[model samples]
Target: MLELLLIACLASPVGMVIEEPPKHEAAKVEHPKPEKKRPSVAVPEEPPTAKEKAAPVPKSTPKPKPAPPAIDTKRLAEAEARAKRLTSENAKLQEALARKELPTGGEIRNPAEALAELREGNRRFVEGHRIRSLLASQDPDLRQTLTKGQAPFAVIVTCSDSRLMDNYIFDQELGRLFTIREAGNCPDTQGVASVEYAVEHLGSKVVVVLGHTACGAIKAVAEANGKPLPGNLWSFQAAMSGLLETTHEDPNETAAEHLRHLERNNAVRQAQVVLDRSEIVRHLVSIGKVKVLPAVYDLATGQVLFLELPKPAKAGESAHH
Candidate 1:
């Protein structure tokens, strides 16, 4: 029985006795390990070529030019024509002046024609007739023509007396007469040269030595009566005295009559002196190119009494006419 109980106890759940593990002897577990990594490096670039380094260039623009001005052909032609016309007019005027045409239209060609002109003019003067030539001298055109040159018809050697009007008495204008005046109408050296120039160069036709009835010079010399005159008048007195000595005196003639005779004789004597002193005058007179005469002007009567008249040159003589 005991054995049977023992067997049952061992087989029963609670009746068995088990052994336990010690506290100090526990269980151990293992884990996996971490991995290590390496660092990264940078790379360098290559240089550029010549063709990739150059840049492109830009182009420039040009400007336009201006046009020329227009010409006026019609105006230029008109101006040229006007200039030509003015030049032609000036030439014509110069040619007319060269021909010696008087503006009054009277022409003097020769000495004879000049003498005839003077005679006709004197006649007209005495008759109080007015001719166109004398009246036209006041015209400006005629005066301008006279300025070009002078052609006197006659030359008169007369006294310086205020009463003697050569222009009025002869009916002459500014250029018609060449007159030489002195106290006694005497031709000294200078006066002779002037007469010669007129005859030789100016073509004077006639020369007259005119004395008056009551000439103061003749009276003064007569009163001197062989005595020397005062100052430079002695030269004139000597000349008059020489002329008087040669003059014939009537014994019964009154003093006034003698003086008048001397006056007339002095006129004739001075006229002769002109002929003797100037060879040019003598030659002209001989050839009938010019005539020299002696005359006395009666102050009271206004009449000219010619003491001597010039005869015409002989035939075959060298007369210019």
Candidate 2:
């Protein structure tokens, strides 16, 4: 007990307390800093850099080119040659044909050839078929080519019947032939001039006297009953007067037979008249330059029947009807 009393007395004298000392007398301590709040850890963001956002660019396309021009020359060379051949042959064929002694049809070989072409074309037309090749042909250009000159293959002298379209009937392409259409197949100054041009300059090889069935001029002559044709129709009437006279029938003859006879004779008689008048045609014949043929055309069947192409007057024989 005495030892405990002695220690307590010494410690109390030093003034140390069990309770904490006052704020002023306590030793100071520095405060610890708070830990910073971090971002959510599953996906973190990097700061944006400059190079990742370069400006965008556009794409380019290419252009197209042009087209070329057209041409048509396949048949033209043959066509040119045929034209020349016909012109040459025509002058020879004419001298070998005449009125009564008519040359053999076969003598003018190309007459049959041309007729074959016409027949084939007409058949195609009737059947509603056309050569597609003809569509490809730029024949309007051919006209421009022909203005420099034309040498058509043959000549057609036909009745001026409105229904007769020789071009269509013959299926002749442009510049392939020379054509004359007249009432009663009459040849006037203008008509003769046309013939002269075809034979002399154009080198037309053959002249065909193409007469059609059921002609209006022939009908007019038949209706007259031996009476003179009307005054205004003199030129037309005179041309067929011989046809009316030669086929004149007794009043008792039926009208049908009268008209038929008139039609046929008109063709034959006109063929004779053509031979009589055109010396260019004659020279073309007598010299074997061209051939003249009498052809009767049928409206119903579109057929052409050649009745005669008399042989040339033998070189020494005086020839007449």
Candidate 3:
């Protein structure tokens, strides 16, 4: 019976074991029941196990940015080729012009050297150390040489003032300077055409637009003050169209001083007019084959003050706007 009772107790879900109480306790005490062992079953692990999840992963780096575009090589090559072609064409054109003109002997070819020659000649004139003009002995030789073909190094556009003689002022001999005289030194279309002929055909290296201190035409135009002059003289006012407007009379200056200022401005304006009117002269100047300068001749001192040239047009620009 005791054996059967033990078997029944083991079979019970609550497997408890009873124990006698200690002498200090009055009631009986029951021990805790033991848990039954569960059957073992396989459990599928998730993609990342605890070990895999705990491990650190490397971070992904970003990509770098691209560089900027370069200039087109094809366009650069075309531009260089075009420049070389133009230069060759210009050289050929100059050769043709020189052959057509039949330049005389002892004429200056370089533009800078020609300008220096003029300056030196003027220095001699001012100092009264005249050499070329005093060589009366060379007159026959000079006349004969000029008969071959004239190649004046400098073209002088001056007033018809009786007192002023370009050959004497610059101390240049015959065939050295090509002079074009007008009442006011203001060039008309014909005057500009003459300049073109001189530069293009005669191979003149420098163009001098010379004005004097006491100019009758300038004085007349200034006195006219927009009022038209009588007869053909009115052409003078038209030729120097904007002289008075361009130059203002200073309150501190006398009438003579103001007239002198107008003369200077007129000289510069006429020089620019030549460039404006003649594309041939402009081209020669742009190529550095020729130079156009404005000069003021002092009647009192017989000195010529060459003014600065006007600002040049930009490349591909025909004239200043």
- Pick the TM-score winner: 3
Off by over 4 Å in 2: 1-137, 248-254, 309-321
* Candidate structures ordered by TM-score, highest first: 3, 1, 2
lDDT of 1 by residue, 142-255 (tens): 467677766666788888888877776666667778899988888788888988887787777888788878888888887887888899888777555476676679999998
Model 1 compared with the native: what TM-score?
Answer: 0.59
In the range 26-74, model 3's lDDT, one tens digit per residue, is 2212333433333333544433355555657556564344443464666
Q: Which runs in model 3 stand beyond 4 Å of their true positions?
A: 1-107, 313-321
Assess the local accuracy of residue 206 in candidate 3 as a C-alpha lDDT between 0 and 100.
Answer: 91
Rank by lDDT (best first): 3, 1, 2
RMSD of each: 58.5, 42.3, 41.0
For candidate 2, give the lDDT. 0.57
List TM-score per model, in order.
0.59, 0.57, 0.65
**TM-score-best of 1 and 3:** 3
Predicted model with the maximum lDDT: 3
lDDT of 2 by residue, 194-275 (tens): 8778777866667777787887777876677567777766666666655665665768877776676676667666666666
Error (Å) of candidate 2 at residue 184 is: 1.8
